[model samples]
Target chain A: MSGRSHAASRLVVAAPYLWLLLFFLAPFAIVLRMALSDADTALPPYAPHFEGFATLREFLGKLDLENFRLLADDALYWDSYLQSLRLAGLTTLIALAIGYPLAYAMAAAPRHWRPVLLVLVVLPFWTSFLIRVYAWIGILRPDGLLDIVLGGLGLTDEPLRLLNTEAAVLIGMVYSYLPFMVLPLYAMLEKLDRSLLEAAADLGATPVTAFLTVTLPLSLPGILAGAALVFIPSVGEFVIPDLLGGPDTVMIGKVLWNEFFSNRDWPLASAVAIVLLVVLVLPLALLQRARQGREAQP
Target chain B: MRKASPGSLRRAFQPWNDPAAKPLIEFRHVTKRFGGVTAVAEVSLSLYPREFFALLGPSGCGKTTLMRMLAGFETPDAGQILLGGTDITEMPPHLRPVNMMFQSYALFPHLSVADNIAYGLKRERLPRAEIAQRVAEMLALVKLDGLGKRRPDQLSGGQRQRVALARALAKRPKLLLLDEPMAALDRKLREATQFELMDLQSELGTTFMVVTHDQDEAMTMADRMAVMDHGRLVQIGPPDVIYEAPVNAYVASFVGDINVLEGHVVAVEGDLVRVETGITGMVELDEEAPALAIGASVLVGLRPEKLDLSHDEPPQPFNKVAGEIWDIGYLGDVTMVQVMVGGEGGWLVKVALTNRRRRAARPFAWEDKVWLSWDVEAGLVLKP
Candidate 1:
């Protein structure tokens, strides 16, 4: 019985690891192999395909650094990388600015009302993500709902030129990723012991002072988690910018998509994806390390 | 209002007795209501300087609400609260000269022990050097000197409790509120921390107001305690007086284990009253009941330990009841014998006998008939 139970437990532990290995790790290894190969006009779009052990050795031997060098030589790749980082950072900040207050309100609401608020937050997610992004197009386009409303209210004399702009992309991203930020933040803020605030006030700290010293510092973990949830996905976002943004909004994800489908440079696209992964992984690994260090201390 | 009470003479720190001694904190006709429930209703009380006062009650008895009002966490719907004779009714919590050691400790998880203690001092915007100095002093005071650099998670429950105490006290507020200070500690540690808290309170001379439901803790540490029930103060006195001379049946029953026998007053002569009970027959009680008339219904309250249990019958008639032993509970230090007397609906009196000897002189067994008796002074005549 013990042996059977031990095997069952081991299987439960191995399930997620096995799934990641089969799907994520295997795909990444294929991408790495494709990134090292030279571009071709043939089917599969890359040279020296792996057929067997000997052919694999030959493919590995013939791998070139030309694709990576080409990426470095092109200024567009660098600009796209920088733009992606900047936009992702801005989206994270915007989400945090809006989500913190919303989460705080939800947490502070009466206990019975919290579930309704949480449902409202997650209600938008029931619809398809693509459909939501598409809905933003109609709302943000020139002479769209915003323009009509503003004109009807006499707030604007002329039609607002809001369509296909960086602002539109930002609106879409923040809207799409808000629940990601709010859920984690709400979870943290809700679990916070209210007596701590009372203790702070009793210690002669004003409300604002208490928030700065106690609430903000204690909610750091939630803030970091929320930021990561928005930041990581926004960095690699393709659908929102593709639908809402103009030509000037050249994000790395857009660049990768164009390279694979329009430019047909499969090796170059793989190289860009590898570099993007490295860029995103570095900060995330650092965050995990810092969290571990904090846990280790106490 | 001051009275020359005899219990005040036993304590040197009886500021309430001195007519000139002003109270450090006062609640005048304070009333707070939560929705349909009145948590605290028109409560007026005073706490003298350097006194360790405890608000003792069961859960939802408004003891906590009273303490919260004093801490400025809850505003009273009516009446006023005064600190050092100044009206602070409208003042916010941060402006109040008070600090509270939370029941959960509420130690800032991100801060080290020293930093947690320095939190209030920093709010005062004291010099950097002065803040450090005070932090060190507080750490030393709580005997957490070297552990200042360690975060709250690194400390044990007892240690965390001390850190909370040190942090609350570091600001040197005139009044400190401790909400069930020892509720989180284990049985052995709780007793030790109680004495430690008492010593610390005396050493600093800071007036501390503690809220607790534990009768033993309140009795052990408080200079004086107020018993509360249904959002009203039932009795206010020293532990000795509250235990021995509780004003009503609620205060008497709530404080300790007491055997209340239903009876009616048969005769009354000055301080002496004779009560006729079904189980114990006619029992003489010494109680000052001026309004009690002949044939007035009353309850005769007797502590379990006060009853003397014996196998042999007495020479003369007394306040005694003979019954067959129904149950025996050996609690190492004492043996609790529950005796069932009379027929149906009989009185089941619990008689606690100390196991002081190595061998029992007369060991009691189940179903054995035993006589339980007490002196006339031991029985308290309480108004039913």
Candidate 2:
């Protein structure tokens, strides 16, 4: 019976591995192969077509870094990459600044009200993502609902120029990802031992000092997880920028979309996609290594 | 049960004995209510300097609430809290000069043991060298010197507990509150840690207040303990005094294994009160009896160990009860025998006998007739 159960458990573990191997790894391999090929006006749009084993070997040997070299030579790609990093960083910071206190409040709420508050935080997810982004356009456009509300409140004399701006993109991104930032933070803060705060206060630490030394350091895992969740996706986000940003906002996601569909340069788009993945994965790997290093210590 | 330790025998340390001596901490009719339930009713208490005091009670008895009030975690709805004769009821927890060792230890998991001990000192903005020296001293005091670099999870339970103590003491506060400190330890480690905590308190000369439900822990470690029930203090005295003379039935039963027989006062002669009990026939008590009227209902309490049990009947002129053994439990060093007295509405009296010899045969068996006797002074008179 034990041996049979062991084999059953092994099969259960292998199911997800096989699924990922077929779907995720296979697609990534295809993209990598496309990234190495040359752009063309043919039906597939790229590559010396794979023929027999001899042609495949010859094609692999002849693959060059010309696409990456072209990307480096062009100022548009560089500007778009820098712009994407800046916006992603700003969006992460704003999300953290707004989400930390909100998550803390949710965790510190009366025990009976916690579930209700958590559901409200995640309530935005039930609606379609595109509809939510579109809903913001109605609020942000000049002489729209926001302008009327501001005029009635007498906070502004004139209708504000709010639509199709970088600020609007940032606001959309931060709002879209706020729940992702809060859930992890709420989980961490909720599980925090309240006595530690009392113990800190029992020491000479003030409330602010206690938060800095005890609460803040202990909740860092949640903060890092939340930031990464918001940062990596926002780096390559296409919808919010395309719908809310002005012409001046040249994010790499839009650049990659224009390269693939408008310019029909699949190889250049694949190279850009590869660079973006590398950019996101490097810091995440560093974070995992740092966590492991701390765990490895006595 | 035993003689007072030499360290507690000093007169200067015994502030409760002197009428003019001021208390270190005072709670004046403090009351706290949590929504509809009163977690702590109007209660007044005081603690003297360098005294290892204990608040003993079962769960939901307000013992923990009283300690939390002192720690400033909960504020009293009405009344003032005085520390060293200054009202501090309005002071926030961070401003108070008292530290607590939480029941869960609450050691910061993200920090090493050395860093945990240094947490409080760093708040004081002390010099770096002084902080390091103090941390090192605390590590040595807790006998966890070489294990300073380890996290709290990496250490054993006892070591983690000691680290919590060391961290709480690192600030050298005037009063250190311990909330069920031994609830996390096993029996053997608890007993050893209790003595170590006592020795440390005596050496540091810091006033310590411990809250616990274990009667043995209160009796063994506390210089004096306050027995609480329903948010009110029933009795407060040294362990010996409390054990020998409990003020009421609740204190008697809560403190240890006891047999309370309901009776009425039949006769009162000066300091002696003779009570008629259906279970034990007639018993006499040597407590002050002027306040007790004739034929008034009262409770007669007897400690299990105070009663003598034997197969042979006792001589005449002794307060004795004849019964048959219903059950026997052998607990390594001592054997507990439960005897049934009086026919239908009988009394079950528990008697403990020390097992002096390992190979000695059992003296009494189940359903065997036995006689139990005790002195007049052993019976504690209480109000019904």
TM-score of chain B of each: 0.95, 0.95
User: What digit string (tens of lDDT, one per residue) describes model 2 on residues B65-133?
Assistant: 999999898999988899999998989888888999999999999899999999989988899999999
DockQ of 1: 0.79
Residue B100 error, candidate 2, Å: 1.1
Docking class of 1: medium
What's the alpha carbon RMSD for model 2?
2.1
DockQ of all candidates, in order? 0.79, 0.85
What are the models' TM-scores? 0.96, 0.97
Whole-model lDDT, candidate 1?
0.90
Candidate models: Cα lDDT each: 0.90, 0.90
Q: How would you encode candidate 1's per-residue C-alpha lDDT over A6-60 as one tens digit per residue?
A: 9999999999999999999999998988998988899988887878886767778
